[model samples]
Target: MPDIVSKSRSGTLGPAPAARTPRRHTVAVLAFPGISPFHLSVPSLVFGRIGAGGAEASPYRVVICAERPGTLSTPAGFDIVVPAGLEALDGADTVVVPSWERDMPLPEPVRAALRRAHADGARIVGLCLGAWAIAASGLADGREVTTHWSAAAELARAHPAVRVRADTLWSDDGDVITSAGVAAALDCCLHLVRKDHGSRAATELARRLVLAPHRSGSQAQYIPVAVPEALDNDPLEQAMVWARTHLDDPLDLDTWARTALMSRRTFTRRFRDRTGSSPQQWLLHQRVDHARLLLESTDDTMDRIAADTGLGTAVNLRHHFHRLLGTSPAAHRMLFRHPAA
Candidate 1:
């Protein structure tokens, strides 16, 4: 028989098939000089918040380690005392380097410690500007990485060997994981949690945090587009209001355009200009939103929920639900189903 190996949710290596030991993972987050308070807090919060609501199967032990035992100054002008030194990483299963100062080079000792941790089978994570530090250590020479969009071009210019992808929220090249700017660090950490635990655990954590569980790497970082909120005290808003009230009915673009008192072509263009999406897209979003609320608050069947949301069929609902929420209606209901309370 072929050997069966366990795998982490992120598809990383876990344990040998024959190993009977329980998995207890240790995560060591590096708190070097000039680290961002936000970056440091993100990992601490995510890991600490684990096991809060009955999730205790394989908990994480998160420790903050510094280059030396001393007080570190944060960019926010706050001082944090970190007593654990590089030796704190001794038995860590994963090592994380959060955001660091942009222009400063990582100390040689820290570089050596990082390399040693990786060689000892620890996964290395670089968040935001911390990706630069990982690249400085020379381990990410040929790896694909993403940093803050503003810094992506600079990193590429400095290190031609590293394939820099600025748009992605994060990317994992086996042992090394790199994430984009500040808030994306949260997503990256959640990604790690999902990888180590499972989708259910990660989704619960995200619900507590009130964040989307999984946004694809291809999703664009939203840039604020300056546009008028409402072009007129127009009938479009009225039609939208009507659609919300009548989601159970089939609502096509023609119906909405007719209600808006505009030609199909004009309504389509103006709707996109006003809402950044076409009429059909907006209606679909509204329907999905209603379906999600129904899924969470009712014991309605998939077919009934689909009809109630105007998605027409359970199959269509499942398709759009997976595409938008990264999970199916049934799974979502299992996680969030509740009666009106």
Candidate 2:
């Protein structure tokens, strides 16, 4: 058995009462065999750091716990000594499982502890490959989740009950939260903070960490194609480059087909085959992307932005912006506008 040391809650909020009362949040990170140091460090770095300038700033208490209390070697050749064991999980309001190596199996005791924590109303988080451990624990059955793209297929194949969406950065099912790859873990953690504390607290933590406070889970993980190398004779690549720069202009099937020197039907077929979306859909994505940049980087009026992006009018812009971004143009600007102050 490992020695469990319970520290009095630090920062503001203090300790909890025996009866029902609000208290400081306890976050326990499970440091298992062959865990990535980068994955293990993220929660501690984000939740452990105290915010400057506030009486209400009660930082989360982060504890690294393991099945056994001792030093464990990381995949990177470094060693970390964790003094607390699975018993420490009893006090946690949230339990985090960081990335583990591919071949490692989650120990049975750890799995039981995680299940118990969830049963007792503690939120569970699985970051990166840690999703595999959570799935193995049988806690994520019938719940939607995601992991790194490379591991998503295997996780889905291995556990048919878990709904796995490979493309998204994260998914939240109330008590159980799962995130995709490395950087996306930060997004998920901040999301939890936002849920518990509010957007202002989460945004403050993100600002202190110098990261984007929020990125939509639905954003494409990677751009569709490699930047086409300059080819002296490649007209298709040239047309693509031209279309990107001229996104503000009215671009229709006829216009693009003429530019690409093909019939409209043939152009539509070829564009779909190459880009995995119809030419019109691709153009809409480009326009939305351009509008997003403008919203973040400039204070342009909605009407001017709409005309500039070829969306025809502010109403049209708002329609597409809401459809694609899940928020209006002005709301998007408020969340992502150039930081002033």
Candidate 3:
């Protein structure tokens, strides 16, 4: 079926008074039979916060629910008791399906519940193979989503209407968000915190959990190892290493090809085949990525960052950074900068 789904509606809220109680957003995590303990804990670990005084300090309330509301066995040779049934999703601000079993048929009740949640304006998240659950519900039919790279082909084959982006670590389509795999699930959930609360809040939370503050969703999810051994002589790998070191210098197709000891045409073909992008495109992305790191971790000026990254001027840096990452350099630093103090 060529699946087209309905859009979710959103409401605006007014500002609260200083002394007002914190508004708690309810998060519902769904568990099913044979679910992984790690996948099931991702959401809870991300959202639940404990205060220094041992009180619940988070602005989110997380709950676990199952279709049958009973003990479910895990592949890790343990069991978890779920106290709430599908009814737990009723008042949830967000509904998360951590992961779904491979090739398992979607239950009709679960599908209907998901559809109802979406219709009621709740955000839906599918971590890893959980995207299969969302796809089966018809909510993600025409949406661009992602899942584990190994299962991406199967997801595309099963739900041809959903655009499966296997390259990205995650995909956020407004109300519907999906992630690539296990660790990517943490990245996606942390991304959700950043989206809802703000970068500073997400950064503090990530520090508490000892996780990377932010990994851009656009980063490649599954890059193959460039070399099997340190001593292995690979021209392409050598060229890439040289390029990384020489990013502050002006580089072009000819220079890169020469570095690899190959002609321009051959270099272009091999580069595209190996990296899935043209040399020019790859170089630009690398420069911008370096710029991002400089912005986040250093006190460099725009001009300095641009010069250091081989981007020439501040104007050129802003133009390319905004074009690629949808934000200005200054703003990125403001959101992500961590002072050494």
List the candidate 3 regions with Cα displacement exceeding 4 Å: 1-18, 49-55, 216-226, 231-248, 253-279, 291-341
Tens digits of per-residue lDDT, candidate 1, 164-200, equal 9875688877699999888888899998887666666
Question: What is candidate 1's local distance difference test score?
Answer: 0.80
Collision count of model 2: 0
Model 1: residues with Cα > 4 Å off, grouped in runs: 1-23, 53-58, 217-219, 227-341
Which residue segments of model 2 deviate by more than 4 Å?
A: 1-22, 53-57, 217-220, 223-225, 228-341
1 or 2, greater by lDDT: 1
RMSD vs true structure, all candidates? 10.5, 9.3, 10.8
lDDT of 3 by residue, 1-341 (tens): 54444443444444332466777899999999999999999999888852222227777889999999989999999899999999988868999999998779899989988889898889999999999999999999889898998888899999999999787778888899999999999999998887676666777778888898866534342556353365448788889889989999999889889988999999998887777677888888889989988886779999999999999999999999998766889887876654321
Model 2 C-alpha lDDT per residue in residues 1-341, reported as the tens digit of each score = 65444446664554344565456689999997677899999888777763664424455778899999799988898899999999989969999998765567778898899999999989999999889988888999998887886788889998899988776678878788899889889888887776566556667878888988777533242425543466655555566777888877887778778887889888787666665567787778778767876776678988888888888789999999887655888876776543322
On TM-score, the leading prediction is 3
Worst lDDT 10-window in candidate 3? 8-17
In order, candidate lDDTs are: 0.80, 0.79, 0.85
